[model samples]
Target chain A: MTAATQPQRTGRVRRVGERQEALAGYAFIAVPMALFLVLNIGTTLYAFFISVWDWNVRTGPRSFLGLGNFERLLNDDIFLIAVKNSLYYTVIWVPLTMAIGLFLAVIVNQKIRGRTFFRAAFYFPAIASSAAITILWIFLVQPGGLFDEIRGALGLNPLFAAMGYGPTHNWMGDPATAMNSIIILNAWTTSGTFMLFYLAALQSISNDVYEAAAIDGAGAWQTFWRVTFPLLRPGHFFVATVGVIGALQLFDQVRIGGGPNGDPNNALMSVVLYLYNAAFIQVNLDYAAAVGVVLFLVIFAAPLVQRRIFGSGPAW
Target chain B: MSTDPPAAAQRPPRAAVDQLAGRIPSLAETEDVGPVGDRSRAWRKRIAYALMIGYALLMFVPFAWTVITSFKTRADALRLEVIPDPFTLQGWEYTFARLDPSIVTLFINSALIATAVTVTNLVLGSLGGYAFARLRFPGREVLFVVVLATLMIPDQLRLVPVYVLFNNFGLTRDVGQYIGVILVLAISATSIFLLRQYFLSIPKDLEEAARIDGAGFFTTFYRVMLPLATPALAAVTILQFQGTWNGFFWPVILLRDRDHYTIPIGLLFFRESGGFSTNWPPLMAVVVIATIPILILYIFFQRYFVEGVAASGVKG
Candidate 1:
């Protein structure tokens, strides 16, 4: 047998094997890609389709009404309230959460005793379910509950009374404070996770920078503002972007804190909650889809605008 | 009244350094002191430690409240009491016995759904991730970008249409409820991204050897890459488990049947069905039950959780 004959046979087998390998790769990815198409991409298109129709699940018939849902959403007062409340929530919650997160990150990143314990304690709430935390928070915010007692004990009630505000009202029942109460609970629960992000970013910074700053006679505050904050840009951008997205989608806490309608003049009405209420409670599918579309546009645009303002590259 | 214009905000960083000059010689007199700078450093360390303790206490308060309240009697729960006088097991007893026996069914449903979602994510997510990471084919980059683009689309935008899609398939009813949720959460964009990052870090030399020995693509992925990816697998499993377990919005919409209710939905039902006379103790009991499993998982998998979160944050 000639050596050329053997070489040719191996070459052909190798080519066939490579082809088989490529086919296997395609096969491996097919299932996830299929699920992605049907569940995520296909349904997104279908959402747009349903938004333009008088689609009723119970009635089993639909008539096309082009841009009718969109037109109505523009004038819907409760929908406007939902949008306003969502914006309020985001505006208040994002900075509060970030500030607390950064503060805790700085603290825990220190080379001190029991730092691990401090980290674990802070992160414990982040691991617990939002439903459970909301339930606990509801307990605390009710009349004669823990929060009211604490506020009274801290002399805050007397101060409010002096200002002609009521003493120890139900925090969740009062429209003025219901949204703020949710913000407090959310900031407490989520800052732990965000603190970990800041910690990760902090650890990645080389110690040489701190040494250089110290050698330059920079004190604690100067070193923080000049070197530390600038280097944590990725952490800041990630936290802010994700925090805004999460705040805008605030639903579970609102739903549990108030009813699905976000009661008490709908002060707690978030856009997602409003969407759910319209679709399910009110059986207004088209309106719900329109609301969903608006929310999507807002959330999609927020990040791009923030990037323009911050002049930062992609967070990651 | 003297107006001090927020000295903390307006103070120069060098002010503290200047103040330290008077105390420097005294610090220098101490035999153990290395330098005046070291004394300032010690003072800074003390401040950091104090802040850490205060913040840890702040984070721990909610958790402490939950634990105490969950053990309180109904009357005690309604009152502003820190410690229940007769700390009762009646809440735990009633929650386990008095609620619908199908509360157990809800627990089982949650476990099954979380496990199924985790398994699907590991299998399908890794498959797609591997293909993206290690395989080469025509149009791969374009297809990968398309997949990644879907990640930016908000789940709320998909809610209405996905609910409709599931309704169309009759999965919103009792029969296919669990399977429907599993399908919805089957392909996690973050997990795929995480796994792809991990696979890219692995060297190709081992796979090259396997290929020379006549092993195929699937075989190399299964026998070579996967075994080496244990840490990433653990991270994805932990993150997916926590996400699926704690998911509320989609599950509530999908599983309308009482028997198919997951933990969060069941808690909501427990409140609604109980109406005005809903007992606080048992409600808190159910909340405690729901939270413990996740807390336990987090405690054990804390490292993996951090790694997974850091992975997403750094690479997103």
Candidate 2:
């Protein structure tokens, strides 16, 4: 009779302990989850709700628009321009940044001298604030500045003139060059980060794969393309997805470089910058909320689109 | 000895094994290769080094130019000179003494807000991370997925609503602005996910052992888990601090008063109010000052920064 009671008592004690553990788990996540719900999820739902209303700070929810704001966005030239510029920037910047990053990673991954210094130097620009970098970039690209000096020294000004793009163009002031200038800056600043990603991926590849390639008498180019690149599929997917998401939200440099109105013909205007201008500068909260929703959809759709193209499974 | 010679001859050469391991076999190891191959390899190495050096220099020129420009007089700053001619500290003096809102004020505000945000993230992230990593509460997987799904939703989507929400709460004004910004960034999905990933990597035996010794959930986490999570905590600290310090978008929206402006917004204000086209030197000086703290952090904690970035890229 005592032995029979012992199992039952132990089972009850185990259940009690589990109850306490569950309580502790809930307690641990309580503050953070509450903050996340109110700030992240709550704000997101509020954005959707306000998108249908004409919200004004003074009067609050002045009128119900019922998708009118989103419809208006379709006809808005500045909004279209902003969208086009963001897509253009992403298409060019993402590939350029990833390529440069991969190249640097490959070089640094080699058992060569001063690779650590090279890695650190490449990553330096990434650590600085975008505002600071943009300020520096403005000076670098100013008329008769370092870029112009280099253009003149390289005899590239005449080449540009011959191509009808004009010689000695103002990099940040000219509509034709302003967006490109921002793209160049973005790539320069971000490529080192992608380089670190690629380096980690490279380090993880097993030596046996290289051994197999060597046994097959594969040349360096063939080995890289056939073996290394395929092995880095996961890294490629991560970089591309993150890159697209980040690129779509381009604002700080553009805002600083071109001002809130996206000066010099709105060439540097991005979707996020437009959202900012709408909400704060123009004081149209409802319209801005609609813009915010569209931006979210676009950013959300990017990875799905990438996954479909890349054939997704586990990323790592 | 005769049997050993045959067995050894049947095995692959040491040089071949090294080559297979992805190392470039040394000259003596590859004696069968001709001079043509050697020359080509040498040329390839030279080209690789040249490309790396060239890119590194290109990446660094803007920074070097910014430093030079800051030391130059306004007139001298306009030129494309490599070095400052007749260098002076007028720009630095003007920035420190004459700039409204003052460099000191901006620095302090940024430091205060970033520190508060970093500490909050570390505490909350670890709690949530620990619960998700070790606890067996109902709905854990779904809740964790919810946390991750929030990451895909761009911040711009929530910007307008978050702004309006805080504005309604009167949190976008003066001291309340600090509360608003801190609340928005206090805990991030990335931080929780990172810490969770880190915790998951640790052996479960440690926590299990603590539990067996009659330690409760909180005690096990605090005593057995937290101390072992130092590396992850450091990574989270660096990433969060850098992110908050350089944050611009939310602060620009939330902080209406000049007194509460962070470094990025302050830099923007300085640029616009200083009449950037004419006052290049002092603006550059301000940029330099704004960047130094992050640069110093990156220098000292370079490994943590790189590891944090790589871990995020791989596991995020």
Candidate 3:
């Protein structure tokens, strides 16, 4: 019988289904939800409310600051720097990485030999220890290091000289180069992961579509532009938005490579990096709480608004 | 569209594979084209392969540098030499000597935590998935809404309170800190969402047969449903494992001492740059070694992981 008869056929077990589902659902999810309430939900609410006060539980006298904590976020020099760096990082890191990721995923998703190997090799960097990878990036990018040696050997040094490398800047050590370095490493490590997602989506798209496009006299470019690209739009938006969210909370590599100071001018000091400093290094829990609250608002609000605008809107 | 007049324009349309694989010669086997395809696909093919190979090399070059760096002496590392001036096994020797015992503990600890999270998520997330898929109960939709809501919260927003709660439970800054972290990682809404989709797509015949055999709800769930969900379970397992193993932020926030530090934290401690840049030689070695597990994982379970990652994106 089809779905129309599904309800009628199962009359004997009908009563049991509802009660058992209730019991089983509660039984199964009870543990995880409790963990969520403790670790996530309740904690989230507490974090928001706590942001407003001088919440020094250890130091006593939790003075009411009202929106004073949020006001401080506007004026705090390092906080401003952190915001600037985070936005810069988001701007650079998300698009470049997602583009590379989508490109690589599209390439590898084709019926290539050693598909697993290429996928895994690209993906391995993502799973490699972040701290170790950070240190490795430093060695590769530092002056007279791997990147320098390779570039020099490939006549890249001469090209860069012609295009002004030495006269322009030191890469990681200089303020300008620091965030760029982080962005480069971040893209290298992450492209494979998002590529995997793209691969899955690409694979899911039927061969019929391509064949149909060919039948319609669509060239490769036309098929890709008119069909594949538009169809992949949903996946693209998801990848882009997730990339944005992740970039805003850029903590790991920055912390590992540059530390809280970012570059000399604090050019790469990410928001979460500053949160880390406020919480762990500087022991200013109140300010950190405030930062966390503001961050929550920004991240939460941005995505919903973006989803409404981009994902929801008809393509131009 | 026919803007071409050069000798290059005389070439034939290419196999789609040729576009992604530059090495492939003009393999136009069929006469399939319109004016849009009048220009040789071979040119586009050439461009695509060049881009793909270029990207692959860019991805690999740094990693190759990291490997060579891992073999360098501390002095060699400092000098920025391309090849080690006189390479020593000292870095590897030192990494192993310091690493073997403590890192083994961290590895095992990490494995146990990831495994715990994976197993718990597989059981709970899928059960919840199946419940949502097959059985309707009061407020089941609302419960799901609550679960999905948790996905939107930034992880850091929950950290302070979870830290406080874990502290109260005596799981802080000490040995065996995995308890707090693993449970937190396990309760992901996206996993549940993924598993439930797979489960709902299941045909009802198997369960109906089991019910006919006089099976109770738990019996049918355990015997019939659970075993049938191997693919989805495998996918969720690998995903959760990756999340758990590569977890840095939570681990960094909770665990203070070196002994308790996971591989990520251990790498950080070992690569202490000390008022300058990092000791990337040993760090790269550690990066390679640390990634071996994830590599091993992908080798065995890539089919599952890739599919799961793909499935989790839009569905997640």
Q: Which structure among the candidates has the greatest lDDT?
A: 2
CA shift of A109, model 2, Å: 1.7
Measured by DockQ, the strongest candidate is 2
Off by over 4 Å in 3: A1-17, A57-61, A109-124, A162-164, A167-170, A200-219, A308-316, B1-51, B78-87, B99-101, B273-279
- Candidate 2 ranges with C-alpha deviation above 4 Å: A165-167, A313-316, B1-32, B274-277
Q: How accurately is candidate 2 docked according to DockQ?
A: 0.43
Q: Give TM per candidate.
A: 0.90, 0.93, 0.84
Error of 3 at B247 (Å): 1.2
After aligning candidate 2 to the native by TM-score, how far in Å is the CA of B68 from where it should be?
A: 1.7
Q: How far does residue B207 in candidate 3 sit from its true spot (Å)?
A: 2.0
lDDT of each: 0.80, 0.85, 0.71
Worst 10 residues of 3 chain A by lDDT: A307-316
Using lDDT, rank the candidates from best to worst. Answer: 2, 1, 3
Best by TM-score: 2
Residue-wise lDDT of candidate 3 within A95-200, one digit each (tens)?
Answer: 8988888777766765555555677767767766577678777766777766776677676677788866862246777886788888988888888879977765
The better-scoring model by lDDT among 2 and 3 is: 2
Per-prediction DockQ comes to: 0.31, 0.43, 0.31
- CA shift at A7, candidate 3, in angstroms? 17
